[model samples]
Target: MSLAADLGIAFGRVAFVMLFVLNMGGLLTWVERKQSAIMQDRIGANRASILGLRLFGLFHPLADAIKMLTKEDFRPARADRVLFGLAPFVSVFFALTAFASIPFGDTLRVGGREIPLQAVTLNVGVLYVFAMLSLGVYGVMMAGWSSGNNFALLGGQRAAALMITAEVAIGASIMGVIMVYGSLNMMDIVRGQGALLWGWLPAWGIVTQPLAFVLFLTAGIAATKRIPFDMPEGESEIIGYFVEYSGMKFGMFAMADFLETVVIAGMTTSLFLGGWQVPYLDAAGVRLPWGWTWALPHLLVVLLQVGAFVLKVCAVIFFMMLIRWTLPRFRYDQAMRLGWLGLFPLSIANIVLTGLVLLLWGGRP
Candidate 1:
């Protein structure tokens, strides 16, 4: 194929990922509420109706989208109109863009076409994700500052500081997996896990880098600012950067949170769970009969991988929510102290241990 054609195909993959994630966000809305309800031992949000028929809050996400659309658009009288408008776009854009470097499946066969499941295979895919995540603080900071609300400014500042602390730990924790897998491309790291261990355990990031897994999970929760670490937008106190925002404007930030949930899940899949690589399936189960024939199994693998990825992410989200409902929210000082002093030291220790493990296993066949 021509170079232009190749580039087109790659961009098409990124578009496909965006569309796929949006649909997942729809389903995830239902799953998260339903699961959260179960965990809390109460029925949560199950009463939207279509001609007097209710579907267990399943239709509520649609209900939500419509409600957000119909709500009155509000802007603070003194708010910077342009920046107020731009903040949500900034949030949603980064939420959507970060997935480009990650693959959803192994490979597929179509009509004489062999398509790799990842959108763009860069050598620094994981590092690239971390960098994008760091930049996301701007969205919050801009929204809060532009709103001219003291509370919003405080919230945004808090979120920015927390993001910086969390990212260092998040990056440090994942470095262990990168060292073990020996690649930054999402697919390569996953494929590396296809190796067997005593016919029982697959060489997953969790099994090898257990310490990093904990650290990554911790940093991830803090980074996303779920309860216990949510000094940024303590929903109960309503100190979020969007304090001055309402209607569709505030909805945008909520949408970003939902989408970032997807991103974090994807990252979890890529870093620790072996991504789209299902365990024990040989590359033989998927054969590229024709150059284009790779599309079918490619689709299947992508579906399964994406499915597994979503599940892992949901599990984490559920756990996070459980903590939210089960545990009391941390005081802002405690939250900051935990992120900087606690996670920083623990992350450094994890890196050293991962290095020692690599040296010990370097001689393995």
Candidate 2:
């Protein structure tokens, strides 16, 4: 294929993936609300329907989009209009960009052409993910500061500090993963997990690094600034960083939250649950019969691998959504304490323990 043609094909495929992710995230907002309402024993969004069709709150997302579209797109008179416009855009844009390096699934082959699901397989994918996640704070900070509102400023300050506290612990917690895998490439980490531990439990990161998994989960929750770590946008006591934002602008920030959830879920799959490789599935992938030729085996193998990957990703997403609804929001000081005094020490301990495990097991994990 010509280089230009190849580039076009790659872009087209990526566009499709982005659209899929977008629609999924939009749906998730309604799901989160409906699920949250169900937990609280109330009708979440039954009032929002189309043609008298409730569809179990399926139409809520469309309703939300319309509301955001018609709402006044107002800016504070004293706010920096340029930065105000850019703030949510920055938040949503970085959230989307962070997904670029993730390996969603394995490659598929058709007529001798193989297409990989990952957008860009950068060598420093892990670092890049972290960097983008950290940068997410700036969007909030800018939004709050540029609003020229005291409440917004306070929220932004809280967000910055909250992010730093959680990020340090989060970064420390994942060091063990790096130590074990010895590579920053997320694809390689998943590939490493395909082996079995003593022929039993899969050698997924969670199996081998159980403590790290817990710590990582905790920090991830805090990093994403959801409940139990939502000090930055505590709706009750303090207006959130984006309090000044409205209309589709605010919708972008809301959408970014859902996208970040998906990103985290996907990363969890790649990091701990073994990306696209089921136990015993080799790096090149499994094989099956393609009618009457050798191509059959290759096709089957690829199909199995894709199935495995989707299963893993779905499992992760379910777990995250469960956590979101099950937990209560943490108070600002409590969240801070958990991040610093609690998670920080635990993360450091995990690093130390991981080293010992590596020394004893010769890094087989």
TM value for model 2: 0.90
Candidate 2: pairs in clash: 228-330, 286-301, 287-297, 287-301, 288-296, 288-297, 289-296, 290-296
> lDDT of all predictions, in order shown?
0.78, 0.79
Candidate number of the best TM-score: 2
**Which residues of candidate 2, in runs, are more than 4 Å off?**
280-297
TM-score for each of the candidates? 0.89, 0.90
Error of 1 at 303 (Å): 4.8
Instruction: Give the per-residue Cα lDDT of candidate 2 at 281.
Output: 56
What tens-digit string does per-residue lDDT give for candidate 2 at 97-183?
887777766665665667776777679988888888889989888988999999899988998898888778878887888888888
